[model samples]
Target: MKKRVWRSGLMANQGFNFQKEHPGIALCGLDCYACPRYHTIGSSRCPGCAGKYFSEKHPSCGFISCAFKHGRLESCGLCPEIDTCNRITRLKTVIKDQPGYPSYQNRIANLIKIKGTGFEAFADTCIHKEALLKTLIDKYNDGRKKAFYCRAVQLLPLPDLENLLDENAKKGYKSVDDAALAVSNSLKELANKLGIEVC
Candidate 1:
């Protein structure tokens, strides 16, 4: 069997067209454009984080595992405790007043309200989403909150995790456990950069 490698921008639907268009060549901090799995079908739509995109592929997103998914809501904003999740807390820290901050917050809140649960629920729903979940948890515990809510953050934004792995992979780690510890620390460093709460 040949090994299958997937990037963030590979897509099957070449005929798909992007309904949501960004007029100006504005760079959203996210690198969805670089993803090999984005709608390569020519649709301007982003399937990675878009709920609609997920619905197309039945059993598509980690959101289904989210508490909110079963709750019959779209996002966290509808939750009575929308302000309480660590994810939301971290987002507020770095995105304050940024052009897209408010919109991001609203999106998460809406997802929770509509989906009715924490992103962890969705993340745990699939193995593919597991790495992203761990990254988010690590970021939250470390103090960096910028990765909150946005699926893109959950996916490729693992600077801290990567650093630790890069260091450990080269260093003579005493054991696999030691390497794990290093990765944990990297996540902490990332959190510190974002001022996320370590609780």
Candidate 2:
């Protein structure tokens, strides 16, 4: 049998339609756009789980193959076997030790949020949040703060994030480094209040 190759896009133009097509949601409910890898520019960029680039890279990934091809589900949350799926359980175990990756608990929470809000609404929210996160990164990120900022954005509510952005904007810092320092300090405090560590 010939190999079944799923090619979505090629290099350079890959993931161009990522926002419109996938809105960053993975089959397993991870927000691909919010991930650090997805934000990276150039050849190392990830097109997200719904992007063609992801299919090209992880064509046979268990979540993609099982949910889309076999289970015929959009997200694992829609599957009756989601709770009992060995794959999910195994993945959860694997990600636990991986720093900077979303914990299994975070994935489950995102799934529940998506199930409650519907795909379009969830995608819209993700897009909006991603924009806010990008602003935070662009304005406030030092070279070492990307992961910390991403984690802070993921943990905080949209309104809070927006408020922080607005507040930070009004501070009139002297330099990009100054803005980054202040934002980083404020985000660290906010993260502490939310019971999340931004390190």
Backbone clash numbers for all candidates listed: 44, 0
Give the per-residue lDDT of model 1 (tens digit) for 81-194.
545666556555745555543333333433443345543443333233334444434433233332342333333335544555456456675654554455555555666777
Candidate 1 regions exceeding 4 Å error are 1-129, 132-167
- What are the C-alpha RMSDs, in order, of all predicted structures? 17.1, 5.5
The C-alpha TM-scores of every prediction are: 0.27, 0.76
Whole-model Cα lDDT per candidate? 0.39, 0.70
Which lDDT tens digits does candidate 2 get at residues 81-151? 86789977876786667665553347777776667767677777778888988997787877777777777
Global CA lDDT computed for model 1: 0.39
Candidate 1 TM-score, C-alpha based: 0.27
